[model samples]
Target: MRAAVYRGVNDVRVETVPVPAIGPDEVLIRVAACGICGTDLKKIHTGSHSAPRIFGHETAGTIAAVGERVQGFSVGDRVMVFHHIPCGHCYYCRKKTFAQCEVYKKVGCTAGFEPSGGGFAEYVRVMDWIVRRGLVKIPDGVPFEQAAFVEPVNTCFKAVRNLALEPDETVLVIGQGPIGILLASLAAQTGAKVLTSDLFPERHRIAAEFGLRHPIDAGKEDVVAVAHAASEGRGADAVILAVGGNALIKTAMNAARPGGRVLLFAQTQHGDAVIDPADICMEEKSLIGSYSASEEIQDEGAALVFDGYRNGFDLTRLVSHRFSLEDAVAAIELASNPGPDSMKIFIEPNLAQV
Candidate 1:
């Protein structure tokens, strides 16, 4: 099998590797569609993790083989796998912070080396724990590329749900990338007026398909001013910083009302960010961070992805490029440096079937 192995910082090469063998309690999935995610790019450029690992996690495909002990699933079933599942009895699980659970931190899918997500390869072995709980069957008639969005949609949906949005509220989503569009679309579903911000006009045009009306051209217009204008002199009730890095943290904070909330969805990197303490203390604004998917909403997220396809929420339209396994390095490069027209990029191992 050909897998894109991460050798070191800023290095990824597609090389022939062994087809991972599954245990008696595990299963093997022939990869169909795997979306390139920002966290995967971050790890590749920063070398945050060790070398010789396969990193694509937004995956979906047909089961090539099932373990002897795996009952409810069969070899021919179509499914999407979550690389992490939390132990229901852990302290973090009890508090609903599943991402921090020790069991959840361990990657359960692999193509060959270290159990990092193996979706970048042709096939990935799903561990026993993931097979039991994290595996979700894709509904019939839906495309694998759409099913590949289940994991990312879960993460975005969790953030939107955490905001506790009201119908009368106004939200300013800072970024119009695929993830940013997902966040803004979900926020609009709650009846809140959504204002999308991005420097590219192409992204704003794509955002309009999801019914997002208000768009702030971050390149030419003032985001804070546009947010305030929409709210009648007050800033947005909630501002979601979907763009990566800490450069916009202060801007997001300033674009919210005195008692508004700011959700840091894409600031996954840990580092120093300059924020005014008086904003939280004197202005009563709140800074919240939502990361990863939640097990409690796993079923809901899957249902949304499945049912949404038939109900005007075709996520596949967001995919602008699809690369084969041999061209994964190029795929990663394009995803790392997105242009105005680039939306969601995918690597389809089985392009013909998917």
Candidate 2:
């Protein structure tokens, strides 16, 4: 089998590696489609993790082997695997903060080397705990490409739910990338008037397909002014910072009403952000951060992705490029430096089969 092995900082090499061996309580999945996530790019550029790891997590594929102890799942089932699952009895689990659980911190899927997500490889070994709790069967008639979005959708869904959006509220989503679009679309579903902000018209055009009408040209127009105008000089009811970096944090804070909520969805790095103390103290604005997926809403997220597939929420339309396993390096380059045309980039190991 071939895998894109992460060698070091800003270095990923495609090399032949052994097909991972599964345990008696594990399962094996032949990779079909794996989405190139922003976190994957972060890890590659930052070298936050050790070398020789396979790091694609947004994965969906066909089951090639099932452990003897695994029941209700067969060898031919189509499925997607979550790399982390929390122990239900932990302290964090009790608080519904599953991402903080010690068990959840451990990666459970691997192709070889350290147990980073192995969707970049041709096949991945799903560990015992993941097989029991994190494996999801794809519904019939849903494409593997759409099923690949379940994990990302769950993360975005968790973030949207955290905002507790109201039907009459006005929300400004500060970005127009794939994840940004997902956040804006989900916010729209809550009946909130969604204003999308981006520099590229092409991205705004793609967002229009999801019924997002309000667009703020971040490069030309004052986003904070646009957000305020939409809400009658009070700023938006809520603002979601879907773009990365600390640069936009101040803008997001200024775009929200005095008492409105602001969600930091893409500021994953541990660094100081430019924020006014008055925004939270004097203005009574709330700045909250939501990271990773929530197990509590896993089923709901899966249903939205599966059922939405046929109900006109075709996520595949977001897929702008698909690369074979051999061309994964090029795929990473494109995803790392996205153009106005590139939306969601995918690396399909078994491209012909899919």
Candidate 3:
């Protein structure tokens, strides 16, 4: 088998490697489709994690082997797998903060090296706990590419629900990338008037399809002004910062009205962001952050993806490009430096087939 092994900073190569061995309680899945995530690119470029690991978590595939201890799953089962599953008994789990759970934070799936995400490889060993709780079987007609979105949608839906949006309010979402579009769409579904801002006109065109008529070209227009204008000069009731970079924190804050909410949906990386305390203290605005997916919303997220698939939302349409596992490096480059047309980049290990 061949896996894209991360050797060092900004280095990944497709090298022949042995298929991962699984424990009695584990399951082996042959990779079908894996999406390149921003977090994966960040880890690869920053060397945040040790090298010699395969990193890819947005994965969907057919089961190649099932452990003796595994139940309700067979060798030919098709599933969308999650790399992390909370212990469900820990302090954090009890509090419903699953991402912070000690057991949940540990990476449970791997290709050949340490237990990092192994979806970039030909096959991955899914630990027993995840096999029991984190894996969702793909329905008969849904494609693997669409099934792969279940995890990401969980994260996005988590953020939207946390915002506690109102149907009649106005919301501004910064950045019109895949995640941004998902955020805006979800917000609009709540009956809220959603405004999306992006420098790329192509992305705004994509946003328009979601019924987002007020697209703010941030590069050429005053996003804050437009957001205010849409809200009768009071600014948007809420603003979700879907793109990373500490610099956007201020812009998101400024786009929201006094006493409004600013949800930081991106800012996953640890760093310092400059902000004025006056914005929160004097203006009474709330700045909040949401990270990862919530187990409580897993079923809802999966249903949303499957239903969206059944509808014309066609989440897979966000996938703009596909690359074979052998050209994983090129896939990373394109995703890292997205053009106006690029949205979601996929790595189809079996691209030659379906």
- After superposition on all C-alphas, the RMSD of every candidate to the true structure, in Å, is 1.4, 1.3, 1.4
Query: Where is the poorest 10-residue window by lDDT in model 3?
Result: 345-354
Off by over 4 Å in 2: 352-354
Q: Per-residue CA lDDT of candidate 1, range 58-167, in tens? A: 99999999888998999889999999999989889999999999999999999989998999999999999999999999999999999999999999999999999999
Which scores greater on TM-score, model 2 or model 3? 2
lDDT of each candidate versus the true structure: 0.94, 0.94, 0.91
Model 1 lDDT, full chain set: 0.94
User: Which pairs of residues collide in candidate 3?
Assistant: none
TM-scores for every candidate against the unseen true structure: 0.99, 0.98, 0.98
Model 1 compared with the native: what TM-score?
0.99
Candidate 2: clashing residue pairs, number:
0
